[model samples]
Target: MRIRLLGGLEVTSPDDRQVRFTTRKTSLLFAALVLAGRRGHRRDQLSELFWPGRADGQARNSLRQALVDIRRSFPPGEHATTYIDGDQDSVALIVDPDQTDISIFDLKLQSDRPSDLAIAADLYRGEMLAGEALADGMDEWFGPHQNKYEQKAQQLVERLSLALSQPGSPEETACEGLAERLLASDPTAEAAHRALMRIHTLRGHENAALRQFELCKALLKRHLGAEPEAQTTALAASLQAGKAGDLPLTAPKANAATGPKPPAPSVSTPLHDRPSVAVLPFQNLSGDPEQEYFADGIVEDITIALAQFRHLYVIARNSSFTYKGKAVDIKQVGRELGVRYVVEGSVRRTGDRLRIAGQLIDASTGAHLWADRFDGTLADVFDLQDQVAASIVGAITPKVEEAEIERAKRKPTESLDAYDYYLRGLAAFDRTITNRSSLEEALRLFMQAIERDPEFAVAYARAARCYATRKSNGWMIDRAQETGEATRLARRAVELGWDDAIALSYGGYVLGYVSGDLDASAACIERALVLNPHLAAAVGVSSWIKICSGEPEAAIEHASLAMRLSPFDPRLFAWQFNVGLAHFCAGRYDEAAAWAGKSMRHQPNYPSAMRVAAAGLAKAGRIAEAREMVARLCAFDPTLRISNLAEILPPFRRPDDRDRYIEALRIGGLPD
Candidate 1:
């Protein structure tokens, strides 16, 4: 038996091989059998699936005739059995699983085993039986399946090409052969052409690469009547110019090769001249090793408190803590960390009389910006932390203006108790991912903070964010209810704390994810950024908004800024995922894969990051890898599917961007 699914659904048998059933009802029966796999459809189910409008007796009679035609068209022992019919029971395809090209193609595409690509390539016969006609009823049943298989074939071609192009690969021959076969199937496939060009270039045949370009142009003109995209044109030109070897692979640049060289630390410019700064772990000069935690806590407090200032960019605690015990050069550290200013300090506890020494250095010039010492009793520890934050903010305020500084100082609610609760909630929220119970505890803490002060916008915002996470991760039993509460809390946060960066950022993110209001989310995130440039969360969320809004370049810029601002962020996975998503939307699949890989490295179990990575790999034509990642992602979040992705995904204003994601997932073989 032969099954064709590239264009329309069909089944053929031996002897009378031309016995084709072009009617919609006949085709619908075939599609239903294929989709159901080995499970023979019940007689009632078959009748309903194919002849839903017909009477029960008529539907059953029609199904029986179709089966009889299938068996009669191909005699027994000549071809594999095409149908398995049981009296008063069900019907199914008795053919071997591998006999159906569509099934084989999907299996090979999803397999990560070494020989999968070759298997997938061999199974794709052509463009799914193009130009075939079926009844309206059958068209509805088979159209999507046909398109999906064709897409899967195209994706496999891409994967085969990339896999073959990598240096020192045993599969190089296999990849080249696969690319040739794919091109034969769809002569105008630009991706296949590009892959061939890369292979030729890698083999030292530059002219061969140029010839591939010409072939692409000819095929496009003859078939689709189009030209290669700008990137393709540029690549061809580079090959012609004998500079094809200079093309960079899709990988992150390695760190500096030389040893660490610390430049002089001195203040040449004031702290206000810089957009962002990082305060490394403060040294413990109290002689007792137990004081290390105290010193570290001081740095954490100062970082968090200063991060609240709208004008000054403060590095996150995780990134800053990376330098805890290492004696590093300040200027090199600044350059590597992408910061313009660096703060170093030491804490001394002498019989409860705490003495703290702090120095701010200009990273660009390796000069000291300011140096100060604070001596007070242990009871003044909290005050000392607040004073440090205030001093840093004051030093950085000149970069904006006196009026802006005054306005930033304006408190939305003058309640120190509320502020403390908010801070505690933040501390808990940051650690909420450690365990399921921790998440519940964190939610409770956030609720407590909100209950203490109904006007505490930041607390409400954080609470909403936590709830959103629960819903997104499938931790909540009632996603609709949790999401509803999250939206309400986010709205309240935005309403109550117009000037609070945390409130605006978290509220905007929740609204974007749950409400699908791109414009409102964008406004909130933009406002948050204006309120606090150092707010990494706001910057990261804004980058995603930009991508979804069809502004990939802007999204990349914002995501880069977020990375620079929070180099050691514990949640760096989120930032990396944002960058990858932007790149994927822009059709830069290689870069997207690289960034997504980084995100996965940072947090292996992050579902959102995994989804982005899978999409990136699929777009880049790494089919086997993409399939593997998709399987992992599906296993991690079983609720994911092509039909529901749009609803679950953050809003993308452009239809094309949304389609790109959906198409990528389809090609990646997302499970139904």
Candidate 2:
């Protein structure tokens, strides 16, 4: 008896008769069971996987039907002869290890023998579970395994091609077949094109080699709207000049000591006036292709670490990751992103061992200022990433910067899945164009991350931030209930991520603005500044606390610091609004009006910014502009009035400041 799961889910009995399940769900269940092996899956888990969004009883019923169908696909068996062993609570697979093709494939992948390697190569007939699409949420659970199998297939190709690419080997001819097959699946694979060209050049087939280069060029132009990387183009040029031996036939191994390290270029006009950087997504060189997510996560972690540096202006991940799967020139990337430096790297993993190679390049001169390689076990992966980030910072500016080192070393969660969910939440939160749906979705994703890892403090902070975002967007339906929840989440974030400036900043901001706990918010933000010192949003929100305390002069300085820390931060508009409040408090009505109008341009419907804009205009004697802002503010939030301001706003310590705001609002046509 044999079962197949790599390419498609199929079963064959001892008699060699193919067995088919009645439905895709049944096949999926059986495949899941077999993959589980000795570890039993709970009935509730299966029900949720197969019938999500259905009523509990209905989901359970559907799972039972799928299980029955799966059991029936077994050979005409008597009692206790089934592959699946199940009680009411859980189900397990009882099949022999040799009876499953995927089990054999895994064994071959782990084995060292060339014979076993060849066997693994033969087993991958096509994409894992070809033509398969699971239920909506099931895809997330299923994708990693699919990637795992696909990675195995790629490893088989690379290993075999390399081994056979050498002279006079019996397996040499198989290299061409493998390269062509890989290219057919992923035509944009520049490496595969190079491999084919190298194979032809090795055999002295110059015509074939030239044809391969032409094919690569056409495919790259048509599909990616670009040319090949410098190495590929150089290889083609060398081959065309009949200097095939000069071409780099083997892939460049990332060795920190041996490779041609770019010398640090002389500093002229620095990348920008301020230290600026773009971090490209690290290439996944981990033979197990499924580890691409881990590579991506590393880049994200490094980006966050770099962003925390107040001295360095970092491009957002959205802008940098746009280069993924594209052939890019470093100078072009610098020009497009307006950055001086670029950090690029590759990640490799073998069993428990891990290797990360990183390079910090001056994008202007394409000169590497620094390059390093880290070797460690899987458990030390985060520490390695931290080292890389800390190293880059030290290379960029070797100052009195222990605080920057500490800032770069913070870890949000130990669980990679939790980190992935948190990133999804961040993406959702980033798109809140004053809409309720995106914020709601962000909350859901953050909640999922929390469910995956309860101690994920950053997720809790982000979840809290969602409520604050809703409040800011005038989308809060139950202010009291939401304020309590927001306060609770923020407290948890501070408790858990005690040293994380990101968590603390979010916690402090929500506490100040949404909970209106001026003292607590001020204290938390002050502590956060001590922790990171460069946290822009924290400084901005700290100014809000100062505004409430009626220290207009101090508030103005903090607001300016916030804007300087991150001029492009979406929340910088609120920081600008705080500056307007400071100006309005100091009787500088003209400056207040200008800053208020600037805030209004960024966040058109922000009730508070709008109120300040209207009030500032009225106080400046701009009656026509004041009336327009007043009308817009009333239309944006009709329920807002003078009496409710006390409950909604942080209390002003100075009576004159409070009176002045109310008087201006009243003059601007806001109801008293």
Question: Using lDDT as the measure, which candidate wins?
Answer: 2
Supply every candidate's count of residue pairs whose N, Cα or C atoms clash at under 3 angstroms.
10, 0
TM-score of 1: 0.41
**Best prediction by TM-score:** 2
Candidate 1: where is the Cα deviation over 4 Å? 1-424, 432-435
- lDDT of candidates 1 onward, in order: 0.68, 0.70
Q: lDDT tens digits, residues 1-672, model 1? A: 567565445566654355566465565566567676665667765676677789979998988887765556544465445555455665666667765777776667655454677677765656664555554566665555555565555556555654554554645565566667668777866657876787787787888889989989877666644456333565686677777655323211222532233333354333342257788888775656776777787777667656765435677777776555544556566766667777777776667777776767656544444555667787777776665544544343332222222222353445435544455455555553524576777778778778877887877888888876775665677767887898899999999878888689989988888777778888999898787666667788888888888999999998887766555455567879888889988999878878887776555556777777778889889999899988888887787788767656767788888788888888888965
Show model 2 residue runs off by greater than 4 Å. Answer: 1-417, 472-475
Give lDDT tens digits, candidate 2, residues 563-669.
76555566767889999989999999888888886775665566777878788889889988888888888887777777766655556778999888888988988
